[model samples]
Target chain A: MSQPQPTVLILEDNPGDFFLVKEFLKRTSLPAYEIHHTERVADAIKLLQEQEFHLILMDLFLPDSEGIQTFMKIYPLAKQAPVIVLTGLVDEEVTLGTLQQGAQDYLIKGEYDEKLLEKTIRYSVERKHNQELIMRSEEVSRKKLEALVQERTRELEEAIKKEKLLVDLKNQFVAIASHEFRTPLSTIRFAAEYLHDYLEKIDEAEIRSKLKKIEKQVTHMTALLEDVIMAGRTDLKKILVVKSKIELRNLVDKIIEDVQNSTRNTHQIELNYNVNSKEIDTDEKLFRNIFINLLTNAIKYSPGKESVLLNIKEETGLLIITVTDQGIGISEEDQVKLFEAFQRGTNAASIAGTGLGLSIVKKAVELLKGSIRLQSGLNEGTTVEVRLPVATTENKPA
Target chain B: MTTRILLIEDTEDLGENIRDVLRMEGFNVVWARNGKIGLDTYHEITPDLIVTDIIMPLMNGLEVVREVRAFEKQTGVSPIPIIILSAKATPEDHAEGLAAGANIYLKKPCSIDNLMNAVRSLIAN
Candidate 1:
């Protein structure tokens, strides 16, 4: 029976040494043979790519490439094949060097007889197969690790984006808070200084106005702080709409009175309430939020303008309130993001505003199952209309 | 004659306070609540010196400095002294304010006396 022959590629420059190696291999247990021989390392590379060899018998020195360079050149191209380096030099140092750099074993020529050669060839073939197995497994594990790293990177990027967005929102909040607080605090400081520095000479009317300014500023500061807190709570879904029986007429009147008293300007706000229901089941805090936002917006926008018309009426079971301002109205573009948090109209940009008023108003309206609309043109005027379904006995703002 | 100064601040009460204090100090001060309005008031009053906050809507302090510099260049007038009053106390902000043609950059919550001194020094120069 013919033994299963392992095909070998021998890279050697010397013809005598090549023939001797070939004869030695023929006497081995690998009897039937297909031995490919190349004198040049480059030629051996081309042959290795074209054909699959079980093992390689290579001379470290060649005409085209020499020593470590020769082996390095063909080593990668000779994929999955175990190399047995045959050296005529017979020096232990050089042979060991090639073996260390991935040649499976080295044979010193004329010294290795048939049995030793046979044993070495068998060992080289077996060792190469095992080495290939280890390499293949390592390759698979490396691929898995790479894919895992890529996936983790993607997840981390998404997390970072979300974190950056939260940071940006927080930064915007801080900046707004600083600007918002500065107003009332400065008002109190200035008013107090006025009272302190000029108390004796100042008349009762002047002292009263200064005190009123301080009072108004305190109210404004409290409201601002409350709004900021409410907004934060609302974002966290912590603030729930609390519904109770509220005197709608009195609430409207009270807001009107406060707004009028607080406004430092001489501008008037004409409130016309034609609601039939005096009492309604609604959230008072939410109601106040919507009313104050609209009312303040009206007053603030119309700085030097005459009167703002605030009209509340019941039509088709829906209570509708519209606050009309003759101030510098918003442009078409600016109105698009007007209800977005921290967004202000282009014309209102220079004006002292937290840009939270409209946003809060929109949120409050949504909670009450109501809708708010804005109508404005550049240089014309602004009108904010809010329509809420009158909450009766069982109905509640959720 | 009182030194006319344009006080540009976004905060209304702050602007009012500064105006009152400046008035008490016997300076003719015209207050504007933003860079754009401040520039407009500058055109109106042609004040001897300008005191402006850094961050404001419409036009910021940097924009104001750039625009005012362009105006000065066009008119062939002695450059108006600009003092930046900002909450940004960082060295970078200070350098940027000066590079934008401001003569002085003062951090906010400044003592009224220090602000007056800065105003006086810049106006004198």
Candidate 2:
């Protein structure tokens, strides 16, 4: 059998009035109203806080809280509940004011019967459910809107990445094209200028020498075109690794030698071999490329610098190499993007490069099962450290 | 007998200069405007060594290398030593050319010395 019950909280400070309301609720043929009565406003507030009741019967006068102030405290909370005011003889005028402040209904204690009590309970419960329905719909709509906002944010991020890629490709193309053009122009310019002077003085031998210079320039342009095409293929993810064992110290020596010949502003390149006892198993050609790229970057960005250091060491079976350049330091903003493809630091704009060097270094290092990190600040110079697995003597047994 | 050489390039002036330079180096040169025609000419005379540009319409240098590799696999014949002439000179691009079965990948606007050295190495190897 279903329990015939509508639980109602009765809040009246005066004991006589509280008993009177309870007795009237009992006599009322309001089905089975389980009347839970509280004598003080504090008890009523406590009962409401603990659980949800079907309805609240509030009186205008309470020992602790009075009249409208009593209902105001309970009114907001009573919205969570259906509050029907139970007024006394002198407060008939006050009961009308309670209804104006969102109370479900008002009734004089002496005059009310079971019919009035049952009707008020039914109407108050229905009104509370309607307000809850509106609130629930609002909450659902807010969650859906938040989810849509998150999805749009992801799409915008992807679009920004695509735009960045396009810009980098265009920059790479322009740098490569200009370099190619300049090589031939330089060669022709030199050859023509020389020929103008040596055309009569040195005869055919000198002219042939000038021709050779021109030939060299033409070759330079062709190589530039090849680099641009190769870079495009790399962007397309068409490159693969050809692994081989490499001697790290020997490779560094070769790179240092190459850099010395290439750059005019000489910086003392100190190669400190802290990992002299170690060799690494990696693609030899790729190792050469890594060192070449690092050395090139160090040289390019450090124009007119006094000194740079290349420190190599072994720690925990790892071959660590540190290249520190005393030239122009990377700005704080550019440092974050230093290893990213086609990103050049603000201090490096005047330096000549396709901005592909460090990216290549990173990729090559990764293929070697190694890692690289950069440290730099504006005017404070820059240091790039690379760590790889060290090939011990046991690995290279004869 | 003039040694006939095939030059495949998208850029005309660069192609002309390369043809002239190689001619002065005592080789008869035939210029194919792009990689598609360059591959067609490969069957005609089977030129001594092919220098092909990487980016071109219809077919690119990498495709040409793949085709040559396929032909070599079927015929059991020694494949032509193809050198990739490209402006994309990243190390990854070099690796890509090698993976595609080219003998060498040379960046565009190479020094004359580098070009000669590469040609000499391929011939000697």
Candidate 3:
């Protein structure tokens, strides 16, 4: 491969000094130096801008400019070129100023020799190549650092947004709970007052029935409120699960009874408990919430007169509870997002809820090593099947 | 026949309302503001039915259910039906209450009719 020649740009107003540099560089034994000579500062500036030279021979006093000002003007343009000043008029102050403005070496033109010029040209070219390498590396490092800073800034912004969203959600929950609680509590209050005001004059059986209804409602309202609070606590990771041996059949029966009594929509629940009289070791508290959420969803979604079915069986070392509801079913698209936090189905929007029921159910089920699958479409009814490992094996870490 | 009920609740308004309603129904009702007081009164009176709310100031409803169950286990006394009244009526809450030895759990926003049905059914069972 042909080697590239070292290019030297000479900026000297004196033709005698320019000829001396060219003659010295040409006769030198070093690699061929491509000499570019310019006698005026403007032509030098134009030459520096057009081509990249390895070395520049600068004269302190030029025809158009003088001193540090000329060096300052041309130094920026000679970014990759190493500068050597060749001036006949030399003083300590001028020498210091030239060297400070990036001149590699200074020589008095009257004292210039062929040997000295060749050595200066070779040394300045090598030094310029090394400086270029360092500047290139610094530019790369600067770009990488800027990119890293931008990435970290984006991550921090997202975290702050999430935190703000959580705060807003909590505030909304508090407001909704407070507002909702008043209506139920007021009903209980009015019922109690009616019973108390006409206690003596009211028919004994009628008064007793009204009071019984009032008592039941107050209890119901209290339970619902407590559930909302507990759901919040679970979301905050404050609720603890207490594990024990629980009869599956009895658990299903209890859930059926609660759902039947809670919602008076006349939705009958059919239970199919195929598992033998075997008690499974699990956290009953967590299980109850899962069942309650599932059963409530079944009743709420099923058409008023339709029946809700519960099928419980053991398979593959797991206890499976499948709840089927014949109410307004979930669309295919909604099924994908059903278990995510704050995700509500389009059809279920008109129904009263905090949109946390399914999310809480999924969390509780996962805690119990249970997997839930839904089968449904709009108006097709829904069947939610949950499979949970009977004994959470202590041998394996969760 | 006037049936006596023991109510365990933490909130003053809820407790008063429950007490007044039961009294209106011509059934004798005793109110305990917290689970501890309810447990004490349950042992003292042994009412026909026990209605309690979970999440109280001291000795929550879950503890009260456990206490009542322990008392029944020690003595061969007739099992008193305990109903849990709570606002936290997630299926998990129902399972928890039942696991804690509650006979039944009713969620809030429940109708008076449903509550009465639950009370009557539990009493019958």
Q: Which candidate wins on DockQ?
A: 1
| Number of backbone collisions per candidate | 0, 35, 32
Per-residue lDDT tens digits for candidate 2, residues A1-398, read 98646688888777887787777667766666777887778887787788777788888788788788888888776647778888878886777778888887887877877677767777777877887898899999999999999999999999899888877788866764554464356346535644563355556865786688677667755755544554454432335555556666777787788777655435667788776554566667767777777876776676657678888888888888888887678888887877765567765643445566777788777666789999987777788999877652322212
Q: What is the lDDT of residue A336 in candidate 2?
A: 80
Q: Is candidate 1 or candidate 2 better by lDDT?
A: 1
What tens-digit string does per-residue lDDT give for candidate 1 at A1-398?
95566678998888988888888878877656688988998899888879888888888888887777887887787778888888875456777877788898988877787788889978887898888799899999999999999999999999999788667768878878776675566567767876787678768987887788788788878888777665554453445667888988889989888777656544687888798987887889889879888988888777667799999999877999999998789999999988877777867744667888888888888878899999998868899999998873334324
Write one digit per residue (lDDT tens) for candidate 3, span B60-97.
78888988888888997878888887776458878999
Model 1 spans with C-alpha error above 4 angstroms: A1-165, A185-219, A235-247, A270-273, A302-307, A326-338, A346-348, A375-382, A393-398, B1-12, B23-47, B52-77, B84-101
Candidate 2 yields a Cα-based lDDT of 0.72
Clashes counted in candidate 2 amount to: 35
Per-model TM-score, in order, reads 0.56, 0.43, 0.62
TM-score of chain B of 2: 0.92
DockQ, per model, reads 0.17, 0.02, 0.03
Show model 2 residue runs off by greater than 4 Å: A1-31, A34-146, A161-165, A168-242, A257-270, A274-278, A301-308, A325-337, A340-351, A366-369, A373-382, A391-398, B1-125
Chain A TM-score for candidate 1 is 0.59
Rounded to one decimal, what is candidate 3's iRMSD? Answer: 12.2
- Sort all candidates by DockQ, best to worst: 1, 3, 2
Quick one: ranking by TM-score, best first? 3, 1, 2
